[model samples]
Target chain A: MLGHLPYALAAWLILWGLYGIVTSRNLIHLVICLAVLQTSTYLILLAIGYKAGAVAPIYADMPAGTVAVDPVVQALMLTDIVVEATVVALLLAIAVQAHERGGSLDPARLCALKG
Target chain B: MLAPWPVALPLVAAAFLAGLGDKLPRRLADAIAIGAAAITALCCALLLAGPPVVYWFGGIQPRSGTAIGIDFAIDANGAGLAVLSSLLILAALFFSLKYFDKPAHMFQVLLLVFLAGLCGFSLTGDLFDLFVFFEVMSAAAFGLCAYKSREVGPLQGAINFAVTNTAGAFITLSGIALLYSRTGALNLSHMHRMIAGHDDSLVLAAAALVCTGFLVKAAIVPFQFWLADAHAAAPTPACIVFSGAMVEAGLYAVARLQGALFGLPQLRTPLLAAGVATCLVGAVMCFAQRHLKRLLAFSTIAHAGVILCGIAVLEPGGLSGAGLYVVGHGLVKAALFLCAGMLLHRLQSIDELALHGRGREVPWVGVLFALGGLLLAGAPPTAMFFGDGAIHHALEAHPIARFAVTVASIATGAAVLRACGRIFLGLGPREPDAPGGGEQDEEPETEAAPIPWSMWVPAAFLLALAIGSAWLPREHAGSAAARMLDAHSWATQVLDRAQPAMPSPPPEEPLAKGLAHAALTVGLAIALALLTLFRKRLPEILRGPVRAVWNPLAGSLRALHTGAVGDQVAWLTLGVAALGASLVFS
Candidate 1:
């Protein structure tokens, strides 16, 4: 049960973030919730990259013999982090515009384009 | 290296255009955007002359027969899609020359960026790379949708689009991570080679999540509320690309991923159901719309559903037919949207009811508009006609789908015909005293501003190509379909050279039955149109019953699309959960 703790936490985090998005009244909160949901992916990647008794993957005349955690997953997570930043920045900008134009960040008030 | 150019050239040009900024002469910016798009189109065309070209980025070829490097494996279908996107982008740029009030360099840059995203998504073989390119494409689209951010409507629409699609991207990323956790492979071919013989729950979960992500982007029902708003709010040129190529890319990703990795057997039933539901919903909502752009957007949703059905059949005939349909529909839809854009720019209103009899003066555009409508409706000698036939042939084994096929075909045709009648034929009320008269237009009604040649040429050119493809001999069409459906060859070339030679090809179906199917569909469409146009003339008893049945249903459907960001996010999450449930149960 303890070994599964990370997975449990990741799943909970994603669902919690989704709940925040569902109930949040402000656009800023929604963007932050999105970032939180995206962090679950980072956590999963880090978990997959882990190895018991593994050393850093830098091979510059390091320890004579050492197992290494997967470096590729780390690279992927880094890239994902960058993408998350870009997405959040853009969403925040749009949210700011929404607040300015609609006079409210509440989605309930933003119905100018509805059927 | 050369294979990557189609995807890279546009990005390079986009950066250069951004640097040049608004100070760059308007014509120079136009020239740069168009030139880059043309070259990229040329590159994709050149790739078709050879076998699949596989490129390894950063000179990091797979080590020890394991795919550790990012690979771009371009098959014939991929090449075909790349050419379609770039060509459409080219046409969009050409039409935008005089469309916008001012020359916005950012618009040109965004178009190039969008082109690159489509090209990259088409050619890349890495799952994560596909995700990256998908984001790039979608982000660019969000920008273009809100390009006129000074307007409240476009900004709201863009927010809804961005928020929902971001959630979709996260779901897709999580799926990729899940698959990586299980198989430790990001390259689709490598993943396939590793997981081919297994039927694990983890794999099912990943597939479902990935598929849901793409389906959301494709605007499949239950996840499609964003499309109509986004298309209606976006500039016409951008709408052309969004409707013409972006949604198709989403469908292509779904099929490509399933074909390369999961082989399409487990998820067929659910996908087929989704396809039918999407088709029915889109068609129903399409006719209910008053805005021309929204109507076109819904039609795109319907066509996406039809293509999904063809794809869900998961046979050579179905896949080939889907390819032809996508190409044909893309061109037809682009022309229609361009014509709609012309009307919007010139008349300043897209309300079909208000625009009745207003377009009769532009006879040439009227002709193009009529042809576009006919092509979309699967008229004879249109590529869609034969493509629809192919889809019918594929559904031969699924008897239950006959009703779905017939209703979808008729509804799709009727939607276009309905728009044509309201816009051009003046079939609706002839209220000459309508408040928003066409005479008090944005441009001077005194001079009757001459329509730009740039706009008409692209619409006509695309219309001719869409219909002209029908003239190809039957044998050529058959061979092209066979080549596209040669999945064994695609797998070997893209995944592993050591795989065995492809088995014998499936027997080709005759086109005669398809023609019969088209005839029945078009006839039903005409009947439906007449019924709609003369509904007021019907007996009071029948009219009352019809309204009773439809009014409440359409009301609820519209209510579901509340245009609130939070509601859209909720639906997206619900969609993901439903997909998960389907994976587990199936």
Candidate 2:
């Protein structure tokens, strides 16, 4: 029961973020929603690495053969975070450019790409 | 050493080019990127011919049947794709030399990074590593899509592309996390061995998430709305990459994963259904578009569907056919985009009606476009015909996929042929206000062009290479499929350092039937072109029923591909949920 909470929270975060993206009116909001959507994965990665009553992965002062949470997923999460940062930065830049091109911030108003 | 070089070389070049910044001369940047790509392609080609090799990073080989470090599992199939990606990057860089006006400083850097990502994605043995490379490629693509940031269309395209793709990526990561929690391994071979005969809920969900995510990347139905807009907004050089290599890379990943990790029987039906739907929808959309680039983009989607159908069959022959088809379709598609770019360069517009009769100025481009259209429809003696033939031979038991492939070929080919007839030969009377005003005021690549040799040479070269792909050794491709499909040998090669021992490959299918199939499709494409161009002159009986069925469906498809992120995400959410539910029950 205790271990499942983090995963359930991760699921909730994903669904909430997706909902926000689907209902988002503004371009910046949509990008933020994307970021939020990505955050769920980070949580899942961290949750996969987490251990109950376990020490951090660092071993500087720890005794020999100490129990530690898995470190690989933490590393994966860090790389994933970096990826999310770059994607969010790119999307935000595009949003700003879209606004500067005399286009409205509302996605409904942006019809330059329609069939 | 060779395995890592294909990925490492372009990355180093990208870093050096990025550091060069504004001080870097455009020609020098182009030369460096092209050099890196050429070397990468050479390394991949060598790898494809040589024995299978597994290169471990930092000398940290697998211990106790599992890996702790990343590895590149270089095989004929992976290396073949890497080679394709590098060649496309080379072609795109060559085209960009004269295609972009004093562009932003990061253009060459991003292209190199994108190539590096594709190579890494193609070669990586770890699931997590694939996601990282996917991000690297997609980030570069998003930036490239909005190269002209001063325009609204490009920005919208970039945003929608980035958002939908990121959502897909996030789902994939969650799936990876679930798989990790179950087996505690990121290595594909390790995971394959861990769950040898299990079809548990967690694994099923992971497979679904992974499949659907890559399916989104593959631009399958309900997740295909972003592709056309992205292509429409991107520069012509970038369009060559987007259609030629990037989307195909998506299919490659899906096929790789299904063979490596998930070989579930239930997975095939949904995948086949999606592929057929995308095939029909994309072909219909391709025919309906007045935007030339959009038309080509939809054709790519349709071809991707055919390739996906081949892969979903999960047979050695099916995979081999899909592999050859990818190379042929990619080269022909690249050539067609180049021709379109040429027309846009010299004529300043890509709208069918706007450019009508204006192409008389560039007769060579028209010739190339027409040839590409014919080859794309599966004309004989080209790689496409051989590949299409192989796939048809594989699908003898399944008629739906065969029918879809043929119809899509005829539809896309006819659409391109019609555009050619109107634009190049001035066959049909022009409608002044026909819908799909289609990207008016496109900024041309160059103001001064008798069509530079730099531009036309690459298109002619790609087309020639595609034509010559007919002679590719069938045994090599067959052996590649043999090595790829047998998970036991693949895992053994990676985990146990065992010599690779694959079963004898499936027998090669004869090409005679495929030749007839190609001839028929090409003839149908030509006839369809003539009919569409002169449809007003045709009697109502010949055209009326077709219009009744096509107009309503095309209208809805267009409405669905509204280029709106919210609607696209809504479709994605619904599709993924449905896919996941099916997986759970299966």
Sliding window of 10 residues with minimal summed lDDT for model 2 chain B: B434-443
What TM value does model 1 have? 0.94
**Chain A TM-score of each candidate structure, as shown:** 0.91, 0.90
User: Is model 2 an incorrect, acceptable, medium or high docking prediction?
Assistant: medium
Off by over 4 Å in 1: A61-65, A112-115, B430-449, B471-491, B495-505
| Candidate 1: tens digits of C-alpha lDDT, residues B516-551 | 777777878877777887687789998998899888
What are the interface RMSDs of all the models? 4.8, 2.2
Interface RMSD of 1: 4.8
Docking class of predicted structure 1: medium
Q: Write down the lDDT of every candidate, Cα atoms only.
A: 0.79, 0.85
**Chain A alone, model 2, TM-score?**
0.90
Error of 1 at B422 (Å): 2.2
- B1-586: candidate 2 lDDT, tens digit per residue: 7888987899999898888856777667777778988998999999988888999999999998979999998887788888888888788888887776675447778888898888999999999999999988998899899987777777888888888999998999899999998889999989888877887888989888877677788898878988988887788888888898888889998888888776676777887788888889999999988878889999999999999888878888888888999989989999999998888887878888788888898989999999999998989667677778888888788899889988889999999999999999999888766555334445665674678887899999999989988888877887787677777888989999998665676787766667678889999999999988888998899688989987888888777776778899999999888888888985
* Backbone Cα, N, C clashes tallied per candidate: 0, 0
TM-score, model 2 to reference: 0.98
Per-residue error (Å), model 2, residue B358: 1.5
